[model samples]
Target: MRVVQGTRPLVIFDCDGVLVDSEPLSVQVLVDALNRRGVEIDEEEAYARFLGRSLSTLAQILHDDFDHSIDAAFLEDLRHELYDRFRQELKPVPGIAGVLETLDSTICVASSSQPERIRLSLSLTGLLERFEPFIFSASMVENGKPAPDLFLHAARAMKTDPADCIVIEDSPAGIEAAQRAGMAVFAFTGGSHAGAPGYSERIAGLAPDVVFDAMPDLIHLVRQHMEGPDRHRSPRAS
Candidate 1:
C-alpha cells in the first residue's frame, strides 16, 4: 500500500455548531434575552427557527412568531447583552483543536452568525486567530442561509470556486445554502437538534456528500480527504 501526500482542499466551516459548541448556550441566551423582554420561547423552537440564521433574520422570525415588533436596533442591543452574558460559557466542540491543528487545508469560516458574535465565540474557544481575515459573516450579504450568497461570497473571497469548497454545517438551512452554491457539504450531527425526529432524513435529503455524528469523525474524514489522491487538484480547474 502507498500513502498519498498532496496539497489540501479548501474548507469552509460554519462557526456556531461546527467549530464551537455554542448552539445550546446561544439558545439559552436567546431565551433569557427574550424573557427579559417579556417574550418566551423554547429551545426546540429556537433551533428550528434560528439555528442558522442571521441576527436580523432571527429578529424577524421572533417578530412573526410573537406578533411583536422587534426593531433592528433592539435586536442588536439584545444580542450584545446576550453575548456579554453567555460568551464566557462558550467552548469549542470536541476534537476541534486537534482537527484545526492537524488540517493541511486552507480553512475559512463562513457563518450565518454576525461578525461580532462569531469573533466572540471563536475567541472564547481560543480559535479566533486561526481564521483571521477569512472570517466571513452572513450579514455581509443581502440574504443569509438557505440562500447561497454568503457561501458564494466566501468562495469568492478565498479565490476558490464553489465546487472546490467543502462546507461543514449543522443546520438544514446551512446545508441548503451550500448546495445552492454548488459546493460539497458535510452535515455535522453534533448540535442542538442533532438527534431530533427526522434530522437524519433531513440531512440525507439535502444530499450532503457526508454526514458526521461526532467532531472526531469529521476531523478524521477531513484528514483523509486532504491526504487523498485528488487533494492536489486545483478546485477551480477540477
Candidate 2:
C-alpha cells in the first residue's frame, strides 16, 4: 500500500509522539485521573493500550473494556489539566523541528488530540506556523484512529488520494489506520514513550513501511522514497 505516484506526496504527521514528546506526560495524567477513581492502571499499560488514540476512544475503552465510564465534565477537566501542563512542560520531539525545516514534501498534522491542544503544543515548541491551517484533529471526523476515518478525511481535505500519501506515526493505532486507508506509514520511535515495555516490539509486529529511530534518518528515508520507480521502492513490494 505504499504510494509512489504523486508529484508532491502528502506527509501526514501524528502529533503527540511523532511531533511532540507528550505521550508520557499525557499518559501520566490519564493514569492518575483513572487511578483516583479506582481504575488501577499504570502508565505503561495506558501507553500500550491508548498511545495514539483520541480522548473519546480512551473514554470508550475505559467504559466498554473496563466498565469505567468517563463523563464529559471529567474529560473537560482533564483537557484543561493537560493543556496547563503542556504550557509549562511540553517540548517538541527532539530534532523534529530540523526535520520539518528540511522536508520537501507537503505536510500537515493529523492528530487524535484536540485542535486547540495541537495548536498549543506546536506553538509552544514553535512548530505551529508551518502547520497552522493544516492541522487535522480527530474531532474533525466521525471516527478517530483504529478506524480510517480521520486519516481518510485528511487525505480528502488535502486533495491527495490515499495512495499518494504517507503517514509518520509512532504507535500501532495510527499505523493500522494509515494502512487501512491505503497509505504507506513510517513508525517513528524517537520519542520518549518509546522506552516503555514492549514499545519497539509492538511497532515491529505491525510492520510499518519502515521504522526509523531518528529525525535525521527520516529525512534520509524520504529522500530515498522520492527517487522514483526503480528507486525508493516500497519494502512491502520486495
Candidate 3:
C-alpha cells in the first residue's frame, strides 16, 4: 500500500560520502586488502568499481573480474581493518554538520552500507543521534543501489510518499536508485574523493535535480526545490 505524503518532506541521506568523508578511507582499505591477496588494484580503479556498492557486490565483482573468491574469514578481517581505519581517521563531510543543524525537514539515512557500518560512521561523526532509529540499510532490503528497493523501503518505513522525499547522494548508483524510487535527488560532490578524474562528469550524466559541491548550500537547495514549483513531483505519485 502507498503511504500518504507528510506535510514535511522527508530527506534521505547516503551515509558514506554524503554524511561522512569516509570514501577515501574505505577505498584505501579495500585496495590494501585486495593487494594482500595479489589483486594489485589502485584506489582510482577501486573507486570506479566499488564506490556506492555494498560488500556483497564487491565480493561478486572480485570473483567475476579477478577470479578471486572471498571467504568469511577474509570478509571478517577486512571489516576489522576498515573499522579500525575509520575510527582513527573518519570525519564528517565538510559543512554537513552545519547543514544538519539548520535544515528543517525530517531526515533519515538510507545507505548501501551494512547497518553496523552505517551506525558506526554516523556515531563516530557525532551525527547518529539525529537519525539513529530512522537509519535504513541495504541489508534491510533485497536490493541495493541502482535498484529502487532500498529507497522505497525507506519511504515506507518513514511513512512518506516516495514523491515527497528527497535523496542526497554522491554516487551515480545512489542517484539512479532515488530516481527509480520516484524521489527528488540532489548530487553532493563535496567528499574527499570528488576530485578524481571524471567523477563529476559521471554524476552529471545521471542528471540529478541539483549538483553542488558545498555542503552549506544544501539547505538552500532543498528549500528551493521544495518551494519553487510542483515540477519536482514524482511520476509515482497517484
**Which candidate number maximizes lDDT?**
3
lDDT of each: 0.78, 0.86, 0.87
TM-score each candidate.
Answer: 0.84, 0.92, 0.94
Q: Which digits, one per residue and each the tens of the lDDT, describe model 2 over residues 1-238?
A: 3445445689999999999899988998888888888898998889888989988898889988899988888888888888888988999988898998998889999999888889999999999998979999999998888778888899899998777787999999998888788788899999988899999999999988789988778887876776645333222210
The segments of candidate 3 whose C-alpha lies over 4 angstroms from its true place after superposition are 1-6, 232-238
Q: Candidate 3: lDDT over CA atoms?
A: 0.87
Q: Per lDDT, what order, best first?
A: 3, 2, 1
Worst lDDT 10-window in candidate 3: 1-10
Model 1 stretches astray by more than 4 angstroms = 1-5, 36-40, 192-198, 223-238
Model 2: worst 10 consecutive residues (lDDT sum): 229-238
Clashing pairs in 2: none
Can you write out model 1's per-residue Cα lDDT over 1-238, one digit (the tens) per residue?
Answer: 0123564557899998889877777777777777777887767677777878887688777777787677667677767767876555676888888888787678999999879888988888889999998999988999988888899899899887675678899988898888788777789987755755666777788777688877777666866655555422222211
Show model 2 residue runs off by greater than 4 Å.
Answer: 1-6, 228-238
